[model samples]
Target: MTAAPVRLTARALLLDMDGTLVNSDAVVERCFSRWAERNGLDPAEVLAVAHGRQGHATMALLLPDRPAELNLADNERILAEERADTEGVVPVPGAAAFLASLTGLPHALVTSADLPLARIRMTAAGLPMPSVLVTAESVGASKPDPEGFLKGAADLGFAPADCLAFEDSGAGIAAAKAAGVRVVGVGPRALPHHPDAHADTLTTVTVTAAPDGLLTVTVG
Candidate 1:
């Protein structure tokens, strides 16, 4: 059964990067594919475990037989290319309007992306730079561990239970729940995960825009 829609009364919103705020599938696939080919690894295998995971973690999983040094090096290389390559990236529909409506809302970005890739992907997606972002480098543990979401909540100066998380991946959903935050899953695949709320897209949700450009978004 699906959880109830998340209400927005907290001081913050922790949004995931890929699939949630933006769709960077092509770019992500290309980066991983290219890196895998260069390293004599299978592109499909690499990509199979890439989504919703940090670069370092992906490297460990994909190139497990490789030396730690090699994995570290390749992770860095992949990160660099991803940061420089943002083609075809764009914000998920209604993301901009949703962000615009919450003019004074205290929200933060929390993603598995590292600093550079986060900035690059977000910019390519045409999303404004959030005042605060919790990326891979900031957390000792990644998604599914709840560290990223919990850190994001802490950064926003709010209790985890008081915050709402927007996520697209199963791992991200697990992380949010582990952090004690309600979650809204975006897109179709996310629905089966039984998020607190589900939407076809950010566009499907309603947000009231005031004359001053402020927005009040209602969930569920």
Candidate 2:
């Protein structure tokens, strides 16, 4: 039997970039692999824990012995590489239309990417750049800390519980949940996080704004 659809209502929407709204998998993998090869680390292992976390944090995790300045420099190089290579960056399925439907709504883009890289990726994906963007530089701590999502909710002028988050990675899901927001996992990659609602793609979900100013989300 088919499970019944789920509905959630919130005052604001918090979204994650990268694997969530933007499809930059090619650029991400290539850069990480090249960086790993240059650093004498296993590329698979490096990527295994990299997604949904800030580049600097990923560097720190992969090379704990390295000085903080060195990690910072390497992370900058990675961001530069990503910004220069927009070969395959595009929106996730239904992301463009879904975002358009959110016009005039309270929403924010919360991402692990720093400002420049986030802007570049979003532009490449043809997404409408959000006015309120919570980047890596916006928080002292990244995902799994809930700082970014909390900031996003605050920027939207709503409490965490008044927001609904959408994410496509385990770390992003954890961050949203930790911030006290109900979250919809946006892709197969987010399934392991066991988000409140799971959709194979954004196309499987719909958003509607009510006269009462609440956003209604329906997921199949």
Candidate 3:
């Protein structure tokens, strides 16, 4: 016999763009591949730690000796390059309906992409943008720091524990947990991190809002 899905309740939901709601892996890999070649680093190695982080943060980790200014500059260039390319950008399976289900509910987007990059990619994927957002520029630190997730909860006027986060990376899961928010792991990248709930895609998750303003999220 198979076990039942995990059920969680929260006042709001926090969404991660890349890998979670939006499939931007092709653009991410292409841009990172070019950056790696420019830095004389292996593309595969660079990509290993690139997801779930701001470009500068990823660069700082990969090249600890590099100057901060250089990383920041490279991050800007890469963001522009990423925004310019959307060939393979698209919504993750069931992302459209998932967002639709959250309409009129409290939710916020928490992503490592800057607003411009987020806009382009979201538009490319044909996903609607959330009214509340915590972009790369919104936080002083990137994923694994918890700053973004904390701010995302605050932006929605909810305590961290009152909100649930959906994430698709180890760094994102760590950040949400550190912020005291429970999480539902989305997609393959999130499995190893062991979020409070797990689903292969948003297709398996359902949300129902209560009269008292709580949301029950059931995952299968």
On lDDT, the leading prediction is 3
Error of 3 at 1 (Å): 5.0
Q: Order the candidates by lDDT, highest first — what do you get? A: 3, 2, 1
The runs of at least 3 residues in candidate 1 whose Cα sits more than 4 Å from the true structure, single-residue gaps closed, are 1-11, 38-42, 63-66, 207-220
Per-residue alpha-carbon lDDT of model 2 for 1-220, expressed as tens digits?
9878899999999999988899888988999999999999899998887889888888988788899999889888998898899999989998998899888988999999989899899889999988888998899997878999999999889999999999988888988999898999988779998899988888878899989898999988
- Model 3 TM-score is 0.98
Residues 1-220 of candidate 1: C-alpha lDDT, one tens digit per residue: 9546544445467889899988998888999898888878899988766777887677877666768787778778888888878888989998888777555677888999888888887778788878888998999987778999989999988889878888888778988999999888988657878898888789866555455533344665
User: What does candidate 3 score in Cα RMSD to the true structure?
Assistant: 0.8
Error of 3 at 39 (Å): 1.2
Each model's Cα RMSD: 4.0, 1.2, 0.8
Q: What TM-score do all the candidates reach, one by one?
A: 0.84, 0.96, 0.98
Model 3, residue 68: C-alpha shift (Å):
0.4
Residue 108 in candidate 2 has what lDDT?
A: 95
The best candidate by TM-score is: 3
Query: Residues 89-175, candidate 3, lDDT per residue (tens digit)?
Result: 999999999999999999999999999999998999999999999999899999989999999999999999999999999999999
